[model samples]
Target: MKLSVWTYEGPPHVGAMRVATAMNGLHYVLHAPQGDTYADLLFTMIERRNHRPPVTYTTFQARDLGSDTAKLFRDACQAAYERFKPQAMIVGASCTAELIQDDPGGLGAALGLPIPVIPLELPSYQRKENFGADETFLQIVRTLAKPTDRSARVSCNLIGPTALGFRHRDDITEITALLNDMGVEVNVTAPYGATPADITRLGAAHFNVLMYPETGESACRWMERTLDQPYTRTIPIGVGATKDFVEEVAALTGCIPRLDTDRLRLPWYSASVDSTYLTGKRVFIFGDGTHVATATRIAREEMGFEVVGIGCFNREMARPIRALAKDIGVEALISDDYLEVEGRISNLAPELILGTQMERHIGKRLGIPCAVISAPVHVQDFPARYSPQMGVEGANVIFDTWVHPLVMGLEEHLLHMFREDPEFNDAAGPSHHAHGAKQVSDAPDPIGAQIIWLDEAERELRKVPFFVRGKARRNTEAFAEARGDSQISVETLYEAKAHYAR
Candidate 1:
């Protein structure tokens, strides 16, 4: 079966808006139609954020598409400014508006507001959620960077720190800690906790460290040309790269990243004995280039897994991932087409899959255990813990999630072992339950395999240490509890209402 990732047909800008809305101070004044504002719920509910992401819809429905969008843009800018009193303003359009090309940047420039105004032009024709984040981040920084005759501040910029890209809260905490250790006070970090003045003060940063690669290249180039401040290209993902990343930042900004010797000691599931099970496993990977690249290093060097199939949907990363693919002595699966991605996954036949949510389905169809390694994660994948696929802690998290699928839970493994042992199973009679999911010609599927539910994991986790158990319990319970009742299954829009009513 072929799945098309073509624009407007799949998912819309809701995920992008979720990232924009989750940020604390910034305002997202999107020049989209009325319904596009639905992205607010993805943040408020999914991420459990307190406030509605400050958003303004131009309300330009199909009726308003071509005629007088210019006036609507102006009104949106003015009204959004008046209402939010935002530190900086992000003027953006969704997939629908991108088709019409109402230049919000030009509008932002013409408005002449006291605050920094950023114009975002993300077209539906080409980009997806990651692209939106990257383009929005770079363009916002490019537009807001102020040039002064004064010397550069000791301050530094933290790029690509969006909410969803690395939604794990500990990722931000570790980054801030590393920056403080380097002694270079962070001037700005986007979408997490920066104000309008902080966005404007972006130029004041002596050097910019890119946390996510998608946002790095353009921002780095613009900063270098405009402000004469260079950016560190390397992103810190694992223990070694993080150390190297900090050291390189130290070399540039004279602030050294404190090498946490305890990075390996982090309370990580995969970084411990779990990763031992993953050693030498032929694995497949696909996602944004930054994550894929960082994960490749962690899998190979840190976790001892072999990257068999590699690919990414990012057009910007073609050159790098293509090269990385060749270096590993394998053909990379880089393309926008999901058919081609499915083809690559078929050919690789990996033991485990680290890929997008789409690939999760692909792996399921192919009878392989898979974990989401990139953008477009579902509600199920959030896993409440501070799990980011970056830094030593992240490496550990990756290690565990990937290996967990391959290694059966201890209880399941014990059951299997006991059933095989004559002494343990000879005394018991076997009971059978009807297999009731979709069945086909007796072909192997995920039907009989263990799911490793949160409840089961939690009951077992109580046997673990106290310090680690609380965080694990909180994250696990949040995910399991929030998942609501398992018995309630609604298949479609019509059934959803019936399920809710019942």
Candidate 2:
């Protein structure tokens, strides 16, 4: 694994925990060290779950290496089964426990538990959280899912709603509501509030709705190949996508596509005169693949924003991101490094940023407005309010969530216009002192003392907004320095802008 202070996704076992925790009548026995159990807090604290996740960790210490570490895993599995009385159990090892090679799965299998015992062979060194979740979900479905004659009535299974997702619980509600409105039945939703029996009845559904591609697409595809159950791949995150999703589902189910335009507020909201200020607003997006791709489309199609930069930290799902970026005539930023994302954000100087909590922090540092659109999220993202990122209601939520930060555009423009007046500055003192003062104190001079600039060039730089003048000046100076010029002229400044524009 690469060294990082923070990561977009945790190790494979954390993913397994998500699957185990999201389901009913399922328990996970994790063969792990003491520190590995910290993943529990991700659910209990951040998600504000009242009940603990159904997981039992061995918590084996280094001293246990002298004894039978395998026995500790077995005992944990036995205790978990007895205490939870789960219909099924999953056995796996954490990153550190994998080094011991105790084969927790084999140990659990030997006990002859009454319930199904699924063994997870996740390579923490090679795979990440999303991969683990996918593998675990696939394993559970493979073991429990039973084939049956396709029902004449239209029904589907919603796959990929899991614990710690970005508003997954609400997404299920919204999607369920939409399907009900269209007279379609939801047979089951896997890895999220589904029992082992629900998994067994998966083949009863006529189709599957693949929500998050990273987590459930593999299992959905497998079902399609093995069970002859078709699935819809559209992710209904925005108005256009939601409309298309309804149409696609209708076509598959032979049901009439009906949408209450009033319910989907994004189209109306975007078309309103109040949103005119949002037109051509430069935006930067970076996150996990599903949200990144969906948000990019919404930004460009519905929000009238110019998507200057787009990316994802998930290397496994980078292909679609790269394809989307290529279609938009820009290179996709595919890397796990937050620094690379931060640097791109710095260079782009977008007016708005939509990304994870990490990007929110970077945008805050750079004095740009940001919205959290994806996971690796903070507690603030998991609000008590219903905020799904799917269906028509989800489109409304996205509109409000993304637009609120930049809604004061007119007021900000007026403030900038009147900033030269002493009265205006005095009136804005408190607000400026709280925000602008820090920026002024922290920022170095735009034209550094080391680099000389001609009067015309300095005058041109002054025309730029104070917030961006430093970056503009730095870029110009770097261009002059690269050309071996000691002093910058207005011609050089324009040349630099043109060069950078290319």
Candidate 3:
């Protein structure tokens, strides 16, 4: 509802469109004004989808406000059904359309269409995109899924993936491959490359795999409760997570997963001497709940990075994020304001940032390397190459994606060793310096020169790597000030480091 240059999520209707677009033979009838059609560009331009989203917008202008907007909505629904011949249809209104008070769901129901019409009553002012998608997907499953006493097979349904998700296509492929390797058949993948028939037959699966927690959790919980079916909560985004996911699936469906550990290169890569520099590298992570939580674990446990800060724009999932942060001994940042995220990033001054496109921009401005791990992404994040954020292959992709921006351990060591050499520190500066250093250096000081540093402490601070020296200096000064010290000394710096280490 708050107007800004940037937002973490789109409107509720847009989430409905994502669900409709991801499924086959399913159409979305959005009661919206002309400008609202811009959601189509997200799929076409960013996802590079060949076909336009199966969405029919009323596109009523201000002039039509005086007219019968209800009739306009009915006509739009009828036209969408006739043209698309969809097996199922979802009806909803955009934020502006919601103010007009036109009952889109009621109108669609009155249309008397041959196909099933799922009415979406999403409160645009109260909810956002992920919530809408979750509701829409849940409604579709609830309406289509029928209770049956059919015996379960060695199969599962992958739930919660939709259009515009972060690398969802590749993630689905990777997960499908892994399931195949485990000799488990995928019965259906709802709201993403699934059909109306697939949704109706969801109960045939032995269990459900919750891929993205944001959109799939509700549906999985409903299915589990109503149908007495179990689900795996493990998100296979990292090496450890993938292994855990496989084990969880095995436990749920009693299908022994034959995982090829050799295919998962992240474990070996992280243990290699070349990746030694990655160890203890400070990282700031902010994104949706699933990616932020998974990335925090991967960065800390697998890639050997210290999660200096972690957060998510998805406030509904804040509790889990806060718990994860507490376990890591860091406070969780739960906010929608990009400025707050930017402020935290500046304060933390992490070496690498794993988040959305907005974080990428923040990292760029801060001369920090970043990898896109969540949605509200940019076109660059949707690479032509297959890069998934799930399964064994996904762990490998994450390792490369996050590590590519950082200097190798050997390279970093060489730079530090020859830093004082004239050839190494030429007038043009070292080759290892970030290209955006000028902009980053021009950033306003996060904390002013309030705390004085003694000459000995300043000299000791310079011994730290330049990339982390600023954070080290700030931490030491803050520690001294907290203990009522007027000035920071070499002993204070060591004390701060030791305190932080514990």
Alpha carbon lDDT of each predicted model = 0.64, 0.86, 0.84
Task: Quote model 2's TM-score.
Answer: 0.89
Candidate 1 local lDDT, residue 310: 85
Highest TM-score among the candidates is held by which one? 2
Q: Any runs in candidate 3 off by more than 4 Å, and if so which?
A: 148-152, 408-466, 472-502
Report the C-alpha displacement of residue 413, candidate 1, in angstroms. 5.8
lDDT value for candidate 1? 0.64
Q: Which residue pairs show collisions in model 1? A: 87-196, 88-196, 237-391, 270-400
Q: For this target, which candidate reaches the highest lDDT against the unseen true structure?
A: 2
Global lDDT for candidate 3?
Answer: 0.84
lDDT of 2 by residue, 1-502 (tens): 5788878889988999999989999999999989898866899999998889999999999899999999998889989888889999999999999999999889999999999999999989987999999999999999999899776778999999899988999999999999988999999998899999889999999999999888898899889998899999789999888989999999998899987778777787688997787989889999999999999999999999999999998888899999999999888999878988988987777778899999887866776778899998999988999988998889989988898777643445456567777766622322322354233212444445567888888777766654455668778888888888888899999999999999
The TM-scores of all predictions, comma-separated, are 0.73, 0.89, 0.88
Better of 1 and 2 by lDDT: 2
Better by TM-score, candidate 2 or 1:
2
